[model samples]
Target: MPRTALIVIDMLNTYTHEDAEALVPSVHEALPGIAALLKLARASESPVVYVNDNFGEWRSHHGEILRAALQGRHPDLVEPVAPDENALFVVKARHSIFFETPLAYLLGQLGAERLVLCGQVTEQCVLYSALDAHIRHFDVVVAADAVAHIDAQLAEAALRMMSRNMSAAICSADGITFDARRAD
Candidate 1:
């Protein structure tokens, strides 16, 4: 069985952006599911990778970015999903996690043939990242309940596209299994 890695996209957010008001409620609803998946992945020793936006901070690294988020309006949301010391971190400047980022190479090094994507902007980052992952030949799974969004209708459409177009498995977080040794 191929190894599965959890790719958490842009969840380490400050929630101070223009769409923050529209996005916060969804994040609150999705927080528990994201937290659950993080716990499962950690316990099973599956790779936990955090692919976060740089927020135009050219000098900011993972720790700095995380610190800024913790200091943001919604530290509560940021805390539960914060990366542990063993977790891998990749900084991105765009919507897709793979866009001009080292994520593809990093996943290759970790031998992650399947990716479980969880995080914010269901209609944007998560959607774009799913397409990029599909093009890269990685089996994509989107934790439906674990992803937040700015627009509910667009998010629903994005999930449909992911399933019908990209062949991504659109299921709840509880439906995900992290153990590579177990039969699917």
Candidate 2:
């Protein structure tokens, strides 16, 4: 059986701020799908990984990113969460979560063969992660309804590119089903 995981990338207070948030309600529409996936992951005891951008928080640290997220300048945009202590997080300084983060090692450790990737900025971080994960040989499933972009037009283009460039299975969030876990 292949172990599966749900990865929610970005969706931070920095990217999603109130002004920008108001401008792009499509991002907000993604919330229910993400929440449902998170709930299913929790119920199934599957790992829920948060691959968030550090956004030049270099001078501080990952902890600082968390603090800034919970109570900071961009809380409305970022929408930081009190992540369950059990969940894994990779605070990324670069666009892709796999870079400079222990995501690959951790995913290998968890024996994750199938990954459900979701998050903000379809053209950048989310796109990079999906492609990179496919490169690393994980069966990638991208929830189309779970990704958002500040530019709807660009977001649509990104989706088309992802659907073509990567071996990512595109499915509506409501249609996802967690198959029984497979042994690695």
Candidate 3:
């Protein structure tokens, strides 16, 4: 049995950064797909983990981060895909979710073998996370329509890299499936 987990990365953003001008629209576009995937994951009893960037706010926790994002730039965008009570959150200081975070230990405890990744900055955080997951021998799946990037070209290239190098499954949200039997 291969336990699968949904890794929602950096989607709890305020979109107030310098790159937000180029990134916010794509993030907004990806919202529906992300929400759909979340619904499906929950209904199937799959673990939904949110791997968010701490943005150097060392004192802030997950709740604080969410609150700040809701008050920041794009509340409309942040409101739709906000983390629910059931979601597990891990805060990372760097682009990669596994970096300086309890994500690896947490996923191991969850018995996650396959990771379905969705969320913001496809070329940056998502890309790095996929590579790290691959190195750790976890099956990687990138929800294509569920991820947003600052630049389309770079994102496409990153996806190609993930597919060719990490052998990640690149597909739309509809292609994902959550099975309760997959985990212990």
Could you tell me the lDDT of residue 177 within candidate 3?
A: 89
> Which lDDT values do the candidates have, in the order given?
0.94, 0.74, 0.91
Q: Which candidate tops lDDT?
A: 1
lDDT of 3 at 129: 97
Tell me the tens digit of each residue's lDDT in model 2 across 1-184. 4788888887654543444654347666777777777777777778888887776666755566667766754454344333566777777877787988899999998888889987777777778888889899988888888877777787777777777888688888877766554544
**Sort by lDDT, best first: what order?**
1, 3, 2
* Candidate achieving higher lDDT, 1 or 3: 1
TM-score of 1: 0.97
Stretches of model 2 off by over 4 angstroms after superposition = 16-24, 59-63, 72-82, 179-184
lDDT of 3: 0.91
Count backbone overlaps in model 3: 0
lDDT of 3 at 94: 90
| RMSD for each of the candidates | 2.2, 3.0, 1.2
**Superposed model 1: Cα runs more than 4 Å off:** 180-184
Per-residue C-alpha lDDT of model 3 across residues 84-178, encoded as one tens digit per residue: 89999999989999988899999999988999999988999999999999999999999999999999999999999999999999999998888
Using all chains and alpha carbons, the TM-scores for the candidates as numbered come to 0.97, 0.84, 0.96
